[model samples]
Target: RAFARSEVWDLLESCHLRCNPLGDAGVAELARGRQRRFLRHLDIAHSDVTDDGLTELSKSDRFPGLQSLEVGYGYSVRSPNAGPAFGPDGIAALLTTEQWALKRLHVSVVSDTPLAGRFEELRSRFADRLTIQQIGTDPHR
Candidate 1:
């Protein structure tokens, strides 16, 4: 279910590509959209995205109007092996970008990993503007 760059130009402001197999290429294309400035919420969770994909998304001024993001839902009950596709470096790349306006960032971190430590650090850095949360099981409950 990949969207053509031109096709999403108008109503892609709040995209939800979760578990749709949009891989890194799709994510990159979306991030590089001509209408990116109009994008507000982007959810790429449980897809085939990678660290480089996230890096591409973090490129200069890519998502200026983005507010909420949800990127790793591998742990969701739907697919245990689904993701955590992009790692801490990927997340760090986005956080380090300038003029970030994210209000919420939802991700999944394996309980015992260096990524968890990094997430704590990221949470502290964006505490004022971002609310990072680990998506829990029982999403419908």
Candidate 2:
């Protein structure tokens, strides 16, 4: 992939692939690319990256300096269904990992899912560093 041999990999600081629909396979490729030591921000909202992709990203040692990550659609007035492909399990995997130096994260989830129950706990753990938006309709409603 281009990212793997990019000459600017060491100098690149931010990457925004919003709405690209790269999915899990694409994310895996990006994760396996050459180390991005200076990269700080990554926005993959609406890229179709699922929990498996998030897990791979979190486990990669290439992004040691990464500080901010935006994985989901938060308050975007785009397509109603165009949110993150991941859920509570993805977030848990990201936060539990010790590889990243993340200081900020943004994500969106449906209100009716099990993520709602763990939202408070996750918020408490990360405090203001984590921003989560509950989007979509509540299935019960």
Candidate 3:
């Protein structure tokens, strides 16, 4: 279930579902379609999506009217055995997208890692528009 169903998410406007270990294929396609037609707020925390899946979702400026994307501690899917892998630097893609009207991107992953570097780049491009971009490590931040 790599894709989201437009029909299911269609009925539920304000979707608040826990991230499944198998990934939320339930709304993958609906998440990809013209967002204005269905969604307004989406809260995804502790999902099984790594930078790979996030990058896939942001293939284009597809999600319009989406104001927030809360990915809290959800980027732990990378292979720890690997030398370095922090969510595939998908922030760059998200920040650069023309249609990402994101306001709250809550990622609890520590900063100054690979993800931070990508965030810096994204900040440069979208300094004014970007808000609540909480980067950097936090013992409980």
Candidate 4:
């Protein structure tokens, strides 16, 4: 609320909302206001965002400078259903859009799930700009 009304939004270039409990509604709210003009990077990992939210974000033409977006459930002991609701459909929404200026996208999904395999297929389609990885575990670790 305060953020949407603040004048400081004009100066913000990168926003990291990781670990916040903001759901689809929050994403809608954040997508509003004038900050989109300057926001370049957005990280919503572990924020409970969903496909509907991603679609809404993609449909908006407000963000012309948004270059990077990170949406995933990072390392945690969450229940099978507790991670982010991201999937291939959401990725398609983001990629097919001509509204945003997205250049790089990173998504995390659970291993062995149908979503992971779908994402793999999507990865090859947008290999230059998209990166998909398994959630709760990192190959580097």
Better of 2 and 3 by TM-score: 2
Q: Under the 3 Å rule for N, CA and C atoms, how many clashes does model 4 have?
A: 0
lDDT against the true structure, each candidate:
0.67, 0.74, 0.50, 0.74
Query: Of the candidates numbered 1 and 3, which has the greater TM-score value?
Result: 1
For model 2, how does the per-residue alpha-carbon lDDT over 11-71 read when each residue is reduced to its tens digit? 8899888878678888888788888888899888767788898898878887788888887
Write one digit per residue (lDDT tens) for candidate 3, span 1-141. Answer: 323533455544555654555353533544465434446666654565556555655664555556666553423436543332235265555555556645445454534344446556565656665433445544674
TM-score of model 4 (CA atoms): 0.81
User: What is the per-residue lDDT of model 1 for residues 1-141, given as tens digits with 9 covering 90 to 100?
Assistant: 245456545656887878787787887777765556777887887777788987887774656778978777355455565546676787777767764544466665432223457767877887765455554455464
TM-score of model 2 (CA atoms): 0.77
Error of 2 at 63 (Å): 0.9
TM-score of 3: 0.58
Please give the ranking of all candidate structures by TM-score, highest first, separated by commas. Answer: 4, 2, 1, 3
Question: How much does candidate 1 score in TM-score?
Answer: 0.71
Model 2 clashing-pair count: 0
Candidate 4 off by > 4 Å = 74-84, 110-114, 135-141
1 versus 3: better lDDT goes to: 1
